[model samples]
Target: MDAVQGTLDELGTPLSEVTFVVFDLETTGGSAAEHAITEIGAVKVRAGEIIGEFATLVDPGGPIPPFISVLTGITDAMVIAAPRIEAVLPAFLEFIKGTTLVAHNAGFDTGFVKAACAAHGYPPPVNPVVDTVDLARRVLTRDETPNCKLGTLAKLFRSGVEPCHRALQDARATVDVLHGLIERAGSFQVHTLEELKSFVRAPTPEQQRKRHLAESVPHSPGVYLFEDERGEVLYIGKSTNLRNRVRSYFTAGETRPRIREMIGIAERVRHIVCTTGLEAEVRELRLIGQAKPRYNRRSRFPEKVVWLKLTDEPFPRLSIVRDLKDDGAAYLGPFTSGRAADDARIALHEALPLRQCTQRLTERTRRAACVLAEMGRCGAPCEGRESPADYAVHVENARRAMLSDVGPVFTALEARMERLSVEQRYEEASVDRDRLAAYVRAAARMQHLSSLTTIPQMVAASPAFDGRWEIHVIRYGRLTAAGVMPRGAHPTPFVEALVATAETVRPGPGPIHAASAEETECILRWLESPGVRLVEVDGDWALPSGGAARHKARIEHAYRGLERRRAAEGRPLR
Candidate 1:
């Protein structure tokens, strides 16, 4: 058998030529420049196979933080007799030479390595890093149980992997997780060097200038754009497979004369990828709302819709459809076209005859009714035998089926026509069932069914302190909510005006204020603060304003506004 590349025992080479160094490090603290590396562990793999491994501990220059030591089980005493990080740094770099660095969350490990190298006056590693966190999120089931940690993945694969925070053990587990993820991602073979770089990033602006590059894009749901040489937008389109759709323009096949002409002028293509189909649809709608692309047909133009109209003529005739208006009288359409609304009226009139011209009704010229009159199907209006009041009753009945909710009630009445069917009433059941479906469609028109019971006061603003402000929510006169600090300076005029507004912003019953840009910056800084409290009703926290007095004033203004708004809203006077 060919040397199976995926199972390479010592070389760490897989079937493909891609080389990866799955690695982990135990450090005295997170900052590699200030702290030091306590342990280093790694396994080398190429293609889908493993090739080699290395693991060792080094003495950190400082005492280990108690929490970290407890978590990793690496103590200062253990590293006291070990060689310093400087001694092992060269070997660790050599072990990963020419290999792409891989870690669970690669940035966390890579950042430390870069810092440590910087400390030693060495250039940071140039090798690209792959974050398994991002990969697993993209490729695996998002709701996978037991969490996506190394231990969980090892358990899921039944790899018999030992549990430890030791660098070597974690590195081995990371490799196992990578293998499991690969097996699950069907047919997507990992590529090395140049191929990997392309798969990893969207085409740069410079590379996008080249011709014959359409075939290189990956097929995924996103918004695509066609741009001219001057960088002006020529057209925009959205698709579940952007690559396939864009490439289709370049392919030789049946093409619309217009598309063929437009393709010649297109110089560049660009896209924005969305994670889900629903997200893509929403994003497409939003972009269309913003840019208003000329070539896009469906959403570009707005139209006036028409509905079925009942005119108050002498005969009170149910005429053809008309345009919708805010008139008191009810109209039944807003349909795609006027003809469709008219067709519905024709169908309704045919199903039940409310017209006196029909043979079922009595006529003025004749003394007796027509055949329908004898069958008791009409009110005998044609023969002048039935009273106008009785004739009017029939018209009212037809109107109820078309206009009132009573249509559904009568539909249920005819549904039990099956009982009549056993008594040979097939015609009655069939007619009623079809009518019920139409009534159901009509009922769907009432979609805006909400009571609007509780009104939420939403406010976004910024404090003057350090160019930051916080968005606050006041519900029923209490500080029931808050958000990220806004970005920008709280202008003196706006602050003074707002302070006045806040004083009169009596508890409860008003529009919620949105945070200003400056306040938003402050909220972001507050969120970043250690031991910050996030709670129901409020996420309020003070931002370290980098010692700016203006920023301090901004924070104060936001707190006061929040206090006043919460009170006015009757939420709680905080």
Candidate 2:
């Protein structure tokens, strides 16, 4: 009734206050597209009292089938003088205005109504609809009714009116069925129209009993935790409305097999209300990492993240490490896997002649050079073949390639690929091309992250539904805290409180912790989203000139062209 109000009011509207128009239809055939409505009947009721009624018989414009005439007792001759659907549909639509429509098999009845409206150049009613079939399924078990067909439900509920394949009588029967189901739903505390509509996926008896667990949760943005009987967290989630979201878990709306099982074991639903959706998201990440809930698959193992670290040495080398330290070494990732970190390492080495060896060397070290040194692929620092000054220059170039500038490295890789291609070594050229692409991707990511990490503080905001703004305060690429400001409220107080309460997180060499990587990526993703406004920045956040990102577009275009040519030539893509 009344479009079910908004989320807040709908949850509290009692069933007694809801107005319903129970309707039924007898059709010429099964499909609305191929047939027409023969009869229509509806009864509007409020608080158990009849307020209005509508009944009509329509001329089908064609002969009724022999079987239909026997079932409904309405033949062509009986409806010859009756008005057509064009006239009956308008009257029926008016009768059900400002009310929720109820029918035995609602889809069947509403489908014909919508079809008739479209055929006649009239807009159909947009009333909230309820199906008695769905309500019966939720309120009555199969053991009680065998099936939820309108006839079976009518007999089970002992309705005053019995269905007889006639419109008005069947409509009246559905009204009684609606009341009976409403009375049974009361046992589950489903007093509101929204509750009734959502009853199809009613929680199991245990979940229904634990509905009180969400009673104290405020109707605001927040994170919710579902815990099993042993008080161990089972699943963690976020919502714009804590009460509504947590309550939905107990309804049929939660259809995931795993979620259903989680709710079966869940004994409590706990929540942490936030001022804005942004805060809720950040908190969800933190809680998921802390609790490591069995149902959470992401950001749960922060300790397992890997990083690509540039070792601090006279002759620098790249290595994959699992831990981040306070040392002065440069780093590039909390890559999802060790293989990815290795790929990035190989790509960087292909572009710059940073040694591929693991040995730690000094200016006076005298270890024999490895095979890579023999090929002139390395500067041969291990054998002291290259002077310290010359090797220092290579190390500086590699450092710049990793942290800021990457044009020279890309240029070198491109030259190597061209030379290989001219020599008719297509496969070798392909390998070098892949290495260049991988290095470019990793370099672009590092440059972007470096720009954000260099900033001391920054504030970003995005408009949300209902005139609310989601505000986020980021420090060193990590979201330190977040807040929400209402339509007319001043954001100054909220911003101050959030910044004061914000956690102090130092940027990792490469987000070695999953929590650090997950949070930073989350903030970066949001900042890149369309319509996100940068509200304030305490320091300059700018990417370096001649960085990897500058060439990424051109490289992608060329990559696509190469792929198309290989496809046309029927070459193996691998």
Candidate 3:
């Protein structure tokens, strides 16, 4: 496979194998629309050897300005007997056919050529234009030439002929500068004509030079890794079309600075083709978590997630923690940030008088009551004002809010926010709104994840783009195996084979067992997408009647409102 991949790469023309026509033009003035070509010169070359030379004088059908006559030795009388531009353009275009055009400051010369074609009923030449001036700027240092003017570069490169403002002389000098730049570019590993063009256009020349690394990637959906020369994964990504996505990093559309820097260091593109886009997404998340590639900002630290834990102490309090254990404590998250976990904890505290402190509490452990108790927030459990039975109610409510339902909790907060709004305390109302949103969203996610993770083993299918079925075998919320059934295939046999070969996942603790929350979330997303069907299940696959999924519309409505409010305040929505 490595041999095949190596053979399939390097799909670019080498500079030594390319034919080039180095051309220059002397015009009556700067603008092609108003000026006419007074002289045209070109040298066709291949492999550092000139194949042919073309030079001709053209009558402008107007008097030459004295300044232009002084710049070039050509006088009005010199072009009187020469061919007209209309008569000379056909042969000039033909002379440069089937070659890449090269010139100093090529835009000006090419602009004139294109204008001539448009005016004379001729098609504009489609040749790729290489500007030696641009190439010199990319390949040469300021100390090497000070400037990229044709005459200065010619002298710096020790060209045998110097540019004398005549078309043929300047063209010859530009050919030397082009050769010098190409040789200099080879030091940067830009040996191909495509690399040369990319070298000039790409923000990082290394990105263009390694473009062939994407050649071996297929057009199928998959995960791709940008690996450095040492075989270390620099960045990991996934796309529906691996080839196109990998190729896009080298194009103008990918403007992210970090990604461009990753492309510069990447030596090759390695890919794993998956059966479906969902599978690709799952693999990308898992790989990024495992590899912890420096270039991948998301999904690299799944363990760093914080959970809102309802501690099983005498007075169970809401505490934000990093690890989820097999203990009896109920957990609400998998929240990606501490601030979100804190928000959820505050929202619960607002509804129930759960203690907000970090100290461990006991049925008999008496301590000084904090301001929370004085403010009628907590039940003063630390000072033994509240009994175990009384606090148990808050503990059970917190568990219900975390695992099963959050409607009453949201209602309590909504009532508070409404009262605050009636008092014209808009800021206090907004705070309540945010805390409510945080708790509702976290509870909704927990329910969605728990619904899938509780199932031991399951087989599901969704309609594929073709007349086939996209089947997935899931175990403990992990995508153990994925396969596609052909249009007329037997479901039983196909599902049997897929299940037999599926990965074995022993159920682990927590709602997202044997997989990261992001991974399970990806699988759940696929399962909930339209047309998905549960082919078989070993256990219940139902969500609770009071689950957050039941209140999905309200959650969505709340989220949209939050987005609008934050947008008006110039803050991030999430």
lDDT of 1 at 457: 31
**Which residues of candidate 1, in runs, are more than 4 Å off?**
1-15, 47-49, 145-147, 189-574
Ordered list by TM-score, greatest first: 3, 2, 1
Please report the candidate that would top TM-score against the real structure.
3
Q: Candidate 2, residues 1-574: lDDT per residue as tens digits?
A: 4664467664566778888999988877766787778889899998988888898888989986533554566667678999998877767877888899998768778888899999999888899898777676566753586556677778888988888778898999989889998999889888888877766665666666667878888899889888887889999999889999888867656544346656678888878888777678778888888889986766787667677888888777898888788788887765667877787677777767778888888898998788888777798888888877887777787778777777887887777766665465656766666666666777777677766776778888898878888888888877777766789878888778778888786544442322455666667778989889987898897878878787776566444322332232221110
Write the residue-wise lDDT of candidate 1 on 294-337 in tens digits.
Answer: 44444432233445554432223355454433433334443445
Give Cα-based local distance difference scores for all models: 0.51, 0.75, 0.81
How many clashes would you count in candidate 1? 72
Model 2 regions lying over 4 Å from their true place = 1-218, 243-261, 406-439, 464-470, 486-515, 550-574
Worst 10 residues of 1 by lDDT: 446-455
Estimate TM-scores for all models.
Answer: 0.39, 0.54, 0.61
> How many clashing residue pairs, candidate 3?
0
Model 2 residue 388 lDDT score = 74
List all candidate RMSDs to the true structure: 24.1, 19.8, 20.4
